[model samples]
Target chain A: MEENEMRRVDLVVIGGSAGSFTVLLEILPKIRTDIDFAIVVVLHRKNNFTTSIADVFDQKCALPVLECEDKDRIEKGKIYFAPADYHLLIEKDSCFSLDYSEKVNFSRPAIDITFKNAADVYQSKLVGILLSGANADGAEGLAYIKQKSGTTIVQDPESAEIATMPNEALKLCKPDFIANVGEIADLINQF
Target chain B: MRIYTLVDDDDLETLLNDVANKYGYDFTEYSKASMKRRVNRLCTLDKFASFAELRYRVLNNDSYFARFVEEVTVNVTEMFRDQHFYKTLRDEIIPQLGVHSHIKIWLAGCSTGEEAYSLSILLHEANLAHKAIIYATDINPRVLETARNGIYPIHLIRGYSQNYINSGGITDFSDYYTANYDYARFVDKLREHMIFATHNLVSDSSFNEFQLILCRNVLIYFDKNLQDKVFNLFDASLENLGYLALGSKETIKFSHLERRYQQIGKEKIWRKMK
Candidate 1:
């Protein structure tokens, strides 16, 4: 962490695939609630079928959790999932627009979509977190967040269950924090 | 609560949900204007005076819902509808696509088959169709059926012919289809490499990887966030240095994926980073 740089954010967006569910179970538990920001998880939903991932995550965390719908308002302290097959895009107003469209990178609930949109909408005000994914989905998008001067974090490749995505991101862009999943969550709570 | 006439937005949503549950189709994430127009057309056919009335009817009537689903969700596309995009492909793009030994192209939201057929021709023209696999999908099952049929209203072909010419047609566009009284059944040969199926962009995960994906005209109806989301999906589905094609009016200016692609022309053709 940079001692000199300290600023609050409105929301957080995490992009992951393949091995993401367990990562959530590990990292979200240690986070503090004093920070005012919603956390959205954009994960790969292999089939279009909907699941209660947010609810499942809710059982593991202190914050509220729910699946996002079209035109959903983004509020602080809540955790939103990129509902089953929709791409979770962040509006300029910092709200959400869950869209039905062609799958990107072969995934509808794509990590890159949420990361990139959040980066564009929130810019320096946002924090983009990347974790385990099979493919290099979040690599360029993490680069984009850094380009916009937003904080970017990638789970340490060695700590990740599937490291292709995080490793590729590390290779392509220099993230602000490249840490173990537990450390990433600890930093979030402290931040 | 007594069922009364519903408002436009509410009625449309209700009807869409009804169609989804009964027919396994979902259009909840489609653009409002296009959905409105399509729903209006369906309502008119059902003799409903208002969106609410139409929606009410949809909830109770399976046959009308079937007809409504057919009317509202059809994409009404044909081969080479936008010649300029194809022209860009033939002239500036395809020549540069030789880096990958095998090519995969996905025609996302390929409503009613014209665009897929057009891509088939483009692939054949480029000598890549033989090796390339084209996956064409739509959320609407009826439309997917129509698309799989590879047939179109013959009246629309005259315009398609013009687009073909503008899109760098090297031969007669008519040579691609057999004209029935009112429909044109496209050539069977074009379907050889195509995998036409029902796939929803909003509610489906990607099933394959591709080198080039043409999802033009599909994202313009969505709001900004949705656009970025779909753009990300393209990033996931594509291989490194893959190409993504968006509609004429759409751009990646405000999207997070903007840096992932450089605009080749009117379309937003993207590449996955190496």
Candidate 2:
């Protein structure tokens, strides 16, 4: 794809598992708050009733961070994290829908579920990034994003804390970029 | 790449319309994303070669349509879910309701009766079981049947026990049920004050006035229009000062009834002021 032919990206969905938390901690503070698109992060985690991961992210992140609520309208320049124990889907009307349906890939808030749903809504104007993890959850989702003509990125497996996730994604689809955390952050900053 | 085509939005609309006309079960206003996911799952589970084949079977076969309704509705629930919410009820709400001579609690969308049984245990522990009547209702008759049976898988008992203890349970959790070969059948005494029935929040009217109404995690499946309708139903069904509880992620903040109800504590419960 030529640089000039790039479509304006409206949504960026990032999916990660096992070792993704530290990677996000490093990448989020570096992201500029003035970006036009919304960012949704879906991470595999246990349901903790006492505290929220979004509240933690909000403290370190430049942009406003929120735990995605049912029927929340998607907004630009904001960051949202999928709530635990639910599958978060992007609606065609630009709202978030939470489902308590059965877990996919042995996990709720499955990366592939969100990625596929977002791809259906955002189509070519989306960006999907799959980061460090120990499972195969995000591979199909990253591939679906590529199939939808959206940009796809995978953390270089060698640079990942756990190579299984990125390596699985690599087997499924040829992402537009494969980079380390620093390079991934740099590419997002460019957007 | 195992890319399976889901039911298209238009196809979903067509099928929902047909179901509504044929069976009076309307799902047209449900969140499309989840609905599509469930329908796609049903197709695969039932071994349908195409969406057309699935549609034909659902429209023509009565038993198949029954299975469709059972599979489509979300039934993922457990005992003492979000233990803190139950803790709030155990510590704060139930104590307040205990002052009343009779307590009427409506557990809307009570799938398989786990929550109903949990509440019954709370009431029994509080010594209010004799005066408390729990009306547990769900849209699906099949699940209502399960709720009436009050039997659940034994494997889940451990988790339920933990949640019960966390929720300030006073008695032994094992005292409530007897372990059978594979399932734990709750004591018949727990069913004495409980009533299980089919009640559709979408198409049915409010059946009774209640001091407390719990429709947790159920509204997340609805769109804004349907949500407002159900909220109004809950509002009408609730007595003045009656409490309404929603799922953790759901709220009445932006709804028309927001001003009339006040959030009680940090939990998802709301009390009607007037």
Candidate 3:
């Protein structure tokens, strides 16, 4: 085998909305805490609601889960969730940049914004995963990630709580992997 | 297949220094991550091949420099954002400030002056409008001008009205503004008690003392050291036992000033005890 066939993963961005939280609960238990990549999560939330997804996920996941704050440094082995009403963007320096611009696809913490920014910052070392949602927010972003040569994954639309988001992502670009919640965890761990 | 080479962190730092040196605005203390993302965005949007080219344009062009500043600062604000915060301000903080014969309130980093206008409305409800003068300041001159205009897209007014009702607004929210064709202009009376000014929090020193200061969400963009510096500034600028309100996510728990302030209620409002 050629030496560089396996590229190191720097960041794993999981974008979803609606029913993605249930999928997260399914995957978080299986994700190896020792994995060498940072995981940033972007799930849509109501405009002014308080966010507690990190705390909710913390109960099931071994790794620390946090609601991202502006300027929070990205570190491997920890999970970060996009705060409500802010678009979570990845900086070139590998940290979080929160913005309050107008909502996209009717979601403030738009999955597309996070995925596109992560693609720009992490480039080929990134892995973008699109999961269940009611809207098509992450579709263009997943395509952008694929264009940057990053690995892109989509949850099998049949297994999605809401197929619209995953189906839209598949329509926009051919992801490198298509798996259900359990298989997606194994695919991530294989990295 | 194209390779995307990320901008080097050191080179970005150098470019920031160049901008500061030429523009006379210090951005060094701002969080590196957000700054890098914004600069990279500007690079793509402006079609600059490199940060070096960006530095040259920013140094030579005045209008581009203004655009650069706008891109760097965060401008996402809404009327009566964090509705409960406004509710608490009306129920608790305003009553406390009423004890003073005249109130001077400072809204730091008042982007587009939504918070400032929101405060003006609350003051009107509390019968404190006549006695209160709000100094709404931001670093971006463009946003300050927008704040002065007090005009917003009519489409957004519905959500703002809901926020107003949520914040215990007693009167018809529509009474505050006149909606025409595509925009809603806030009543001129609401603009009277407010003064919009350009104030740079990073490099500028405090010039006036206030009975209450609200610096919400703005500090989250700053580094820990810079946050401490601003907290010190707030501490100095606030009158004895004056109130301070931070964004919901922000806290003074770890700051040096934490012990000096006491949390008032469920709200982010705090009273300086010492």
Candidate 3 chain A lowest-lDDT run of ten: A1-10
Q: What is the DockQ of each candidate?
A: 0.01, 0.75, 0.32
lDDT of 1 by residue, B1-274 (tens): 1112223556667766776786666666665544654465455556667666666667677777666656665454556644567888887667666556777788898877778888888777887777778899876677778777888888988978887887898888888999999999889889999888877676678788888888866674465556667777777888777788875434566667767666665545655565
Question: Mind giving the per-residue lDDT tens digits that candidate 2 earns over B189-232?
Answer: 99999988899999999889999999988998888889999999
Task: Name the regions of candidate 2 deviating beyond 4 angstroms.
Answer: none
lDDT of 3 at A138: 92
Model 2, residue B48: distance off in Å is 1.8
Clashes of each: 13, 0, 0
> Among these predicted structures, which one has the highest DockQ?
2
Q: Write the per-residue lDDT of candidate 1 for residues A1-191, one digit (tens) a residue.
A: 57458457777788889898789888776667666888888888554243467777888877777877555568888888887656666655555655454466788776766776677567787888999989988787788788777888899989889999999888878889998887888767655
Mark the regions of model 3 whose C-alpha exceeds 4 Å error after superposition: A1-11, A29-38, A48-51, A55-65, A71-78, A89-97, A104-106, A116-127, A134-136, A139-151, A161-164, A167-176, A189-191, B1-11, B47-53
lDDT of 2 at B205: 99
What's the CA error at residue B208 for candidate 2, in Å? 0.8
TM-score of 2: 0.98
Please provide, for model 3 over B1-274, each residue's C-alpha lDDT reduced to its tens digit, 9 standing for 90 to 100. 2333345568678977887888888888886656666677678778888767888888899999999999877888889988889989989899889999989999999999888989999999888999999999999999999999999999989999999999899999999999999999999989999999999998889989999999988886777779899999999999998999988667777788989899988777889998
Q: Is 1 or 3 the stronger prediction by TM-score?
A: 3
